[model samples]
Target: MSAKVINITMNGLPMEVYEGMNVLEAARIMGIDIPTLCYDEGLSSYGACRLCIVEIGPQDRTKVVSSCTYRCEEGLEIRTHSKRVMDTRKMILELLVCSTPGSKTIQDLAAAHGVITARFKPEHEDCMLCGLCVRMCKEQMMATAIDFAGRGPDRRITTPFDEASALCRHCGGCMFICPACSSRCMGPDADTTLCSSCLNLSPSCVEVYDHQQCWMPPGCGTCIRPEGDYLPATGRISEVKTEA
Candidate 1:
């Protein structure tokens, strides 16, 4: 038998997804780029990274939810690039960069979302605690070698008893899957936390309209606005296509 499907509206486009599919997977099917640090298709959905957040509900009253964990509901309306969603993503990127300054993954994600500066002081920590390594080890490698220990600032990934675990096969899956393990192009001692070298094109449609018309990976070209038309400096696009 075929899998049951659920219909949802994303970025004004209607799509049918497999039942129990999360918003992040649905958006990805439409070529929408939703940033995520903790999510991997092979492992279970752990909403540790809130980067793939989307705005849901009426325009006047929408709530932000982590797309990775939010299962699609029938007739559910989702805005992937609303003003509120963009703002929330930028803030999350800022915090991620602040926590781990040397992570190329975090820096690239922040630059893509137009987060140029991190206002908070930098901690220069190596790990963001996304738990990809832990999950990858347990789920895929079948070895619960390393796991998080402690609470708050004391929290960290460590082997049992802080010593090497005999259960570990040393398959290197944990380090291989870690985003923080990747180094930035600017090297470790760069004066800045954010490296815009891999910066993506700024999404202009979202600025003109309250939400974006384009949902491509870079999300800069192919806007819904007419080719020759431009919103006046003082005026914005008031018309928005929505789902019922």
Candidate 2:
């Protein structure tokens, strides 16, 4: 059976999309840009990062919904860039920066949204708690090696018991899927042992600390590039491209 289609109005423009599709996918099909952090088409819509939020409703009543996970409905009205939506997005970015000021991903996103600084004290950590790595590990790799632990501000991503688990495939999938980890190892740190290529014995080494471009040198260790589509800095793997 064919899937049903949904008709929606976005920013005064009317469009038709597939039923059961999320607002983000519908918006992208219409060329509307909705910034996101924890969204990947290959994984479940976790909605952990509220950056892709959009306002949805009628003239008198509307509410903000995470576009990545909010399924589209017929006769739905969406406002992607209203004052309320932008304000919410800005605040979300501010909080993300406060949590991970050292992350270039967060920094770049905040700058783009004119979030000059965080209102809260910044944590020195790089992980953004996006849950992409955790999703990939469990769903795709079936490793279930890492997950979010703790609660409130104490929550963080880590291996079980904070120790390396034997269930870890060591496939470097978590490092590759992480937005913070992508540019984290670009430098020649005193602790070179922390490098993924060094730890995995992969020949492809990325100079993340190089400051200009994240360059990957060949022949240091095996390099695994994501298949199907290519992304610049994030390097997230949607599908398995190669193993060597």
Number of the predicted model whose lDDT against the real structure is largest:
1
lDDT per residue for candidate 2 within 189-220, as digits (tens), equals: 31322123222222121222111222233221
Residues 94-189 of candidate 1: C-alpha lDDT, one tens digit per residue: 998887765667877887777887788776566788999899989999999888899999998877897657887756576567775433324433
Q: Residue 188 deviation, candidate 2, in Å?
A: 15
TM-score of 1: 0.75
Error of 2 at 127 (Å): 2.2
Off by over 4 Å in 1: 188-244
Model 1 steric clash total: 0
Candidate 2 displacement at residue 191 in angstroms? 25
The CA lDDT at 206 in model 2 is 28
